[model samples]
Target: METRSRVLFVRAGLPEPALNVEIHDPDGGWLATSDLVWREGRVVGEYQGAHHFGDYGRGDDDIARRRLIEGSGWLFVDFTKGDYYARPRRLALLRRLAGHLDCALDPAGLAAIEDSLELPGPPVRPCGA
Candidate 1:
């Protein structure tokens, strides 16, 4: 999912983010290793899978981790399966990321990427009977 996210950004003409990089504070204290990190943009992206919501209070841990990272002044963005697999959602997500990173998107590039994906097309309408 992280790799896919990276590819999505690249295909959309956005800067590719680092994968599984450790974020650190000014004092050099390790904050958390983000699934995706745009260092210059100070943005962290996380892919939340089933493990993130599994038993053993993992959800709580995720919330705390996000708080810690945000408190350290990094913009946190999380993506779930839905956000990844859906086309419209993916476009929206990319736009949101672009806004956060102050990156301009090429509409033609995004259209090409969307065309390349084997996603299901829009619903068909029945002719008037």
Candidate 2:
């Protein structure tokens, strides 16, 4: 899970670190708990594991939840295991998102941020990307 989050941050080039966040419905009902939430950008990052679709009932519920969230003016980026493991595809998605959101981070800035992390090659994706 940490690896996935880190990859997302690196790919998205977000300015802030990804934090565990949850969004509630307008009525204060539980909507979804996102792996990362970029509150300023109104985006949600979801790391979907295979268990997310392990059952028919769960899958149906997920679909309904997603619809409700989307209707509420939030963009969700759902990443599966494949997306986390596949660098090119994941990076492409991140770039597309950066373009869509008009994010300020450039590749160099992102690289510097990743380097400062003191971890490894990649960086973590910001929340809400």
Candidate 3:
């Protein structure tokens, strides 16, 4: 999942993010270890498989963890498997980043990336034909 997320960001020509990053404050307090993070953008994204959202502690943990992270002014981007490989969903993720940072990303650059991505596993059609 992390590999897929990394591929998505890199292919999109966004800033390559650090994976499994342990973030801390000036006082050395452990805030959280994010899945994929663009530290300078204060952006962190997580890919949660469906099981993680079930009747388990994982869901609660996610809620608390996101709250803690966001409280400190960091933004969290959450999505599932389908959102990763699909072009429209992936574009939405990038748009979120551009909006959050108040910048416009080059559409042509992202379109180029989307054209080149190859997903893992059997065929799943893109969100729209």
Candidate 4:
């Protein structure tokens, strides 16, 4: 969730999606606790940490959760550490996913965000410099 918050900040003013959100099944049972839910857009974002693929049961649960979420007309974007570590790749993936849902991020707005994050430039120099 800390990482998600940082990413959201880097992306600028997009609303923080609801975290650890619960969704119910037709029979009223708990379907899943989505990491981040974009309620109005029916989009969900999941941050897949190390534990996600570590065991069979965990993997199976993820599959089942995805199936249920998809069944409800929501799109999910699954992210791993590698994705978060690379800004350009992450942005590209986000753009593609947003495009798929016809809710693309505004390019100008994104550029402003990048500028605010100082992302396009090289990393900050040492104090001596």
Candidate 5:
């Protein structure tokens, strides 16, 4: 999933983000290890799986971790399975991430990536049939 996310960002002309980076406080205390980190942009992204929100009781811990990271003056972004798979959600996520990174998005690149996904498209019909 991390690889897929990276591909999505790169294919959309967004800068490639660092993977599994450990964030720390100024005092050298460990905050969290984010799935995606843009140190220059001070942005941290997490791909939350089912365990994070399911009955496993990790949601509270995740929230606390996010707070710790945010308290240190970093923007935190999270993505769920739906956010990665659903077209609308994926586009929104990419836009949001780009905005956080203070970068412009390439609509053409994004469109090309979407086309390359090879998902089922509308049926074709003979002209004037």
Candidate 6:
């Protein structure tokens, strides 16, 4: 899922967020270990796979952890399989998120990704660069 998300960021021409990072509070308290994190932008992304469901999914502790991060002014993006599989949708969504971080996505890069998707070839985990 992290690889897939990285491809989306690449195709969208957005700066790549650090993978598997831990966000901390001002006093250096552990907040959450995120799948993707852009500390300067205060944006943290997590790919919530099906395996994360059950009592582990959004439990009381998880909610509190989220609140801690959000209270520290961090923006969190929870992505699912849909966000990873659909390249176009991912690109569009990345554009929106990038905008929230005061960044821009390159149109040509997204267009190229769309073009590649139409090619006749074996499916790649992340067809984008």
Candidate 1 C-alpha lDDT tens digits along 1-129: 666667677767788788899988878999898899999999999999989878669888889889989999999999987776787888888899999999998786788656445323322223341
Q: How many residue pairs in model 1 have overlapping backbones?
A: 0
Q: Model 2, 118: alpha-carbon shift in Å?
A: 14
lDDT per residue for candidate 5 within 1-129, as digits (tens), equals 766776678767688788899999999999888899999999998988877878545888898999999999999999987777787888889899999999987777777656444322332223354
Model 4, which residues run further than 4 Å from truth?
Answer: 9-13, 26-28, 104-109, 112-129
Query: Residue by residue across 31-98, what tens digits does model 2's lDDT show?
Result: 87767666777777677788897999988988887887777777877777665456565555566556
The TM-score values for the models, in the order shown, are 0.84, 0.70, 0.76, 0.69, 0.84, 0.78
Candidate 2: residue 9 Cα off by (Å): 1.4
Candidate-wise lDDT, in order:
0.81, 0.63, 0.73, 0.65, 0.81, 0.72
**Per-prediction CA RMSD (Å):** 9.7, 5.5, 7.0, 6.9, 9.1, 4.4
| Residue runs of model 2 more than 4 Å from their true location after superposition | 7-12, 109-119, 122-129
User: Which prediction has more favorable TM-score, 1 or 4?
Assistant: 1
C-alpha-based local distance difference test score of model 1: 0.81
Cα miss at 120, model 2 (Å)? 3.5
What lDDT score goes with residue 45 in model 4? 78
lDDT of 6 by residue, 17-57 (tens): 88889888988988889888887788888777766666754
Clashing residue pairs for model 1: none
Please give the distance, in angstroms, between residue 47's alpha carbon in candidate 6 and its true position after superposition: 0.5
What are the per-residue Cα lDDT tens digits for candidate 4 across 1-129?
434433443353354466688876657777788877777777777888899989999999999999998887778778776555566755665675566445647566567544343334332233354
TM-score pick, better of 3 and 5: 5
Backbone clash tally (model 3) = 0
How many clashes would you count in candidate 5?
Answer: 0
